[model samples]
Target: MVKAKQINVNNLPISILDINEDDYFCLTHMTKNQQEGSKIIEKWLTNKNTIEFLGVWEQLNNPNFNSHEFGGIMSEAGTNRFYLSVKQWVERTKAMGITARTGKYGGTYAHKDIAFNFGLYISPLFNLLLIKEFQRLKEIENNQYGLEWNVKRILSKANYHIQTDAINNYIIPTLNYSQKKEWIYADEADLLNIVLFGCTAKQWRDANPERSLNGENIRDIASINELTILSNIESLNSTLIKNNVDKKNRFKILLETVQEQRRTLDNIDFIKSMK
Candidate 1:
């Protein structure tokens, strides 16, 4: 799947496409503010060194690349009549390193390796700036992912301790059978699931066989907002459990809490950043 993202390079928003986990930078957007940006790309394409570099990249990365056509283009490169367009290069050599996209993100995009080479044609300073900005963008994304992972871990720990402490302290002692006592934790977890997700874990699994086959649970696919509401309610439910509230009354309070917190968090866009 191809995903489109953008980054600011030298104050210009350049389009980047994520194709099969590789980032392809938009060469057209790189020089969009310059005079005759198209001509600049054309000049870069006609360079013999650029041609050789692109050919070698295609040979290395593209299994179905048309080496015969690439050799012909390479021979004619840097000659007076030699000219190449992004479309021509892609079609002739079956190149996967560059692409001409259409629609909203339409542009001539190149793989990062080829993009850095093309960046030199823009300017040494501009190229350096582009590299720096790209690195910064990647760092931000990595940090965000790491933070979310940590939040999930902390939520899991909090939920486990709060709910099990309540169960072991209050509910477990009343059950006569050991098997019934063992089920207390799962039953308590399902209470939270029913409140936030409108279904029990078992019900969710039954409804989604493929996901169940892949070892995913309802909570595994939950949005950030849903998880936050779940965390809030688990703590609330723990308090209710400790206070000796009956199951029916505790369910009502937890449901209300879930609804109220969801309404509050949904309105705040930052808190609703879904995975």
Candidate 2:
């Protein structure tokens, strides 16, 4: 089933349908201000010029368009008896650019291309306003999308900083002479990785071959709760390290911090709302 959306054009509410990511505006909604809107669409369909434009559009976009039947249709155009409905056009030509819909957003809906032609047939002034309103709606959608993307990027950066700070202060300074020579400085991240994930980085990689191959690690797949818990324990672990805490003692304290933060964060109404 297709979902219906609405956009107002000059105080006129136009119904739009989303089909395969393309937008189709309801001609019925466009006619709401008119004395007879359905008749207007029927009149537009009977014109020889409208048929030619639709035929060309179908040829370019629809491989399934029936040229043989379209030839018969163009031949009969502009005759006194020549009349068409959105339904008949699709059935005869196998066109995907326009559709006859039913239920909620129900009515004759045409792609923006054909709908613009109808707008011209209606009046140049009305068509201009229609196009302007659609453009405005598009701009608003783009702005909203960009805003959400920035918010997510901020969160990812915050998590990155928290993890790195913990490793630098708490884990790096404690590296032994032989350990420093054997392991790279970056390996310190695994100090917190083991506390939260219950596995070292190498162990997690070996256990999940598919994810490791895809360039994903255990931390990359962590739940929001785990990341939040990880962020909270970073400062706590750093403080413990300053006091000369041993590895075993730090692990016990960090483990308790993870559980306590998860319990507290999971119950917050606003945080739950975000999830």
Candidate 3:
């Protein structure tokens, strides 16, 4: 399903849809303040230059675009008898740059490239305001995304330390290693890694040589959801270690916890947004 968002361009609310990772702005909303609602869009679609612009855009971005049909439409543009709608254009040309959506947010939405051009057609001032407002919205979203990602990464690190502390206090005492006891910490970390990711650090690095070459480890590139889950399992594994649970039993419990938490988090929209 497409996600809808809105931005107020000079006090006029314009809707935007997330269509397959591309933003499509509501052309209907852009013309709503005018005397003519959709007629403006209809007029714009009949312009020969507009048809050419759309044809070129579709050719560049949509491999499925029917150039044969577009050529036929282009030839009739600007004629007294010629008329076109957003739906007709899409149906005839297999266009991806614009769509006619129905429902609560129903409108003629065009890809940002086309929408900006339409904004320019409306007025240079309106186009400027729309671009500025859209960029501001994107900046806010980017800032929020970065903030949450850093928070999750930091939380995972803090919990990792807590788990290591448990290893030092409990697990390390029973181990026989004298000078090279660091393997104990590595083993415990790998236990959590294996349970959650189904791979050890070395195994993951081996499988992803390019990422490894760039100095990014498995956790470094994990999604916000995965980091949250890793933090949870780390804390839980520490508790299990303090309770003197054997490594094998702890692995089983951590594995089960990882599976359950993933299933739960996967369904949460808020968590999905963070990613």
Candidate 4:
């Protein structure tokens, strides 16, 4: 079953229509400014330019787009008594994505990619304004993300030396003396440190003794989201190390991993309640 979520964009609530784990789109109704909205949609429906624009978009993004059905809709787009609704477009043409519904919280919204096109149809000025606002929001979000990441990086670095010293003082002494057992045994905390910081405690201290060990000029603390990623990384790294994989290679592999696990990581929804 598809799960739907309501999200706020520029004070407007939009529904996130998820068809599956991967397939989804945003849906909202057209704006309430009736005269302006109708004029915009009417012009869009009748203009040859609008038809061509929709055609190109469907070709590129919609795998299940029904071109024959859409042709019928386009043919009847501009009659004196004719009417069109978002539901009609979806039902008739299997448009796959369109704005629908009614009431105070309703207005048209589209998938991020398609919304820009709709904005252009409304007015070039509207499109420009929307783009500007969205870009500004994105910049603010990116700056916050960068700050959080750097903070986590510093925390992990500082804890490295402490973890390494613990391992050397506590773990190493407990190991059996065997000819091939010259390696140091890592504790859970050390492993977690490795996952988050991409280095062992001893390694970090050796590389930056002044900061990791001495605690002077240490980096900022991590955000909750970063801590979660670090925790997962540590668990995975622990398993890899137990299997005797090379530490340097494991660090390189983890660095190459993408952060596309879910929207929970990229979006601010998780921490919104705290605010």
Candidate 5:
């Protein structure tokens, strides 16, 4: 599954494609703010330095690369009459550094190194933003797979379902003992919401109308650390409910817990140390 991930640079959306476990960033997407996107790709492809770099990269990484054919291409490179497309370069050098595709994720895509070089050639400022955004995305990706990361995120979501089930069986029964007491359920849910998020879910939606309109609530964008704390509070809330801890007392304790966790997690110096 080769999905496209987008990052914005200079307000232009650049797409990165993953094909065969390697990243291929779209050169076409990178030049939406510039004139002659394809021509710019062609200019980069024909440069003597770019050609040599591509050849060297192929030599180091691509086992089946044809060096004799690459030598022929090098002799012709840098001449005004010389021309190369990604397909031609790949075909000539037996290179895997770039690809040319022609569908939704189409256009010239290059290896990360080549993409960075092309990004710099476009604009150094854009290149800086590109790297920053790319690294941010890569970090997000890592968060989904690592064991410690999975344990925390999964614990939060899993415990939430458990709490909801307990509420359905126990808490809702006292509210008229009704089968369809939906607001009763909502009210209890918001008890935890107010404790952790400092607002009811409705208040969060109202405050963030743009995010709400897009169907994303406060929980959807919580930090990993916040989610970990939320997971902790869920366990405590579950125990408190079973023991019949009054809502007023629960709120005070939970609010204190939220503040303590925030002080620890939100400190800039502490976050830098983790990195």
Candidate 6:
């Protein structure tokens, strides 16, 4: 029940119905002005070819897809006396995805992957037009997301330096431990920094070796994404240290968290580019 957004394509505002959190497809209806288009889609949806296409897509993408349910839908498709709406198909087949609802701006939509197949049913030219529009929309969305990401990266960098300085001044001096012990703790901090920034403190230092001895290195010059991840890692590590959690386990958790964030950002970027 995710609220869907509408996208304008060639002056026509098309609703993007969500197939999942990250994926969507288009829909239109069969009113007098659009009956031709609607009939084309209906013909496609109820056809044996369409049923096969849907079945194959479900099998490939849906782990919980009910084959028996889909079989029932397929069995009833394409009879003059048997009319099937999108809701019926979805409910009957227990489909993970479907286009539903109609009347007054309601039309047929399918998952983007499914829509592409429907496009072919309309006409090669229509399919090409839809693909081009979608690609353009994706590009716009990606650019926006990328810009947002860059901004986030910048903020993260600034915050990281602030946090690091606090650690250096307030936390580091409080330890009565020897230099070796201090260095060991510093090394642990550096490990988390490296995981986020792709460089150990020493490596960063060496890379910018020409800088003044007191100058900040690469870790201090992190992008917003790295800094954001680093901040979370720092907080989590602080708690883990307090809880006497093993460094190895903490590192694993940190890496996994970073990986998940990266994937989410990447998906957003991907979706935006498709715009």
| Top-TM-score candidate index | 3
User: Per-candidate TM vs. native?
Assistant: 0.63, 0.65, 0.89, 0.56, 0.54, 0.58
Clashes of each: 0, 0, 0, 6, 0, 15
Runs in model 5 with CA error above 4 Å? 147-149, 152-275
Q: Cα deviation of 48 in candidate 1 (Å)? A: 1.6
Per-residue CA lDDT of model 4 for 181-242, tens digit only, reads 33453444544455555566667667776676556321234455666566455545545554
Candidate ranking under TM-score, highest first, comes to: 3, 2, 1, 6, 4, 5
Worst lDDT run of 10 residues, candidate 2, spans: 266-275
Which tens-of-lDDT digit does each residue in 1-275 have in candidate 3?
A: 78888899768999999999899999999998878877899888888999999999999999999999999998898778999988899999999999987888888899999999999888899999999999998998878767777898899999999999998888767765655458888888899888878899999999999999999998998876788899999999989999999988998898899999999987765634645
lDDT of 5: 0.80
User: Model 3 compared with the native: what TM-score?
Assistant: 0.89
Question: Largest lDDT belongs to which candidate?
Answer: 3
Lowest lDDT block of 10, candidate 5: 266-275
Give the alpha carbon lDDT tens digit for every residue of 199-250 in model 2.
Answer: 8889998999999999987767776566667666665666775677876898
What lDDT does candidate 2 reach at residue 86?
82
Candidates ranked, most accurate by lDDT first:
3, 1, 5, 2, 6, 4
How many residue-pair clashes does candidate 6 contain?
Answer: 15
**Could you tell me how far off, in angstroms, the CA of residue 50 lies in candidate 1 after the best superposition?**
0.8
**Model 6, runs deviating above 4 Å:** 29-37, 69-83, 102-108, 167-275
Q: Against the unseen true structure, what C-alpha lDDT does each candidate score? A: 0.85, 0.76, 0.89, 0.54, 0.80, 0.65
* Worst lDDT 10-window in candidate 4: 21-30
Higher-ranked by TM-score: 1 or 4: 1
What would the per-residue lDDT of candidate 5 be over residues 113-180, giving only the tens digit for each residue?
A: 88988888888987888899899888876755354445666888787777777677677777656766
Residue range 37-122, candidate 1, lDDT tens digits: 76788889899999999999998999999999999998998789889998999999899998888887888889999998888887
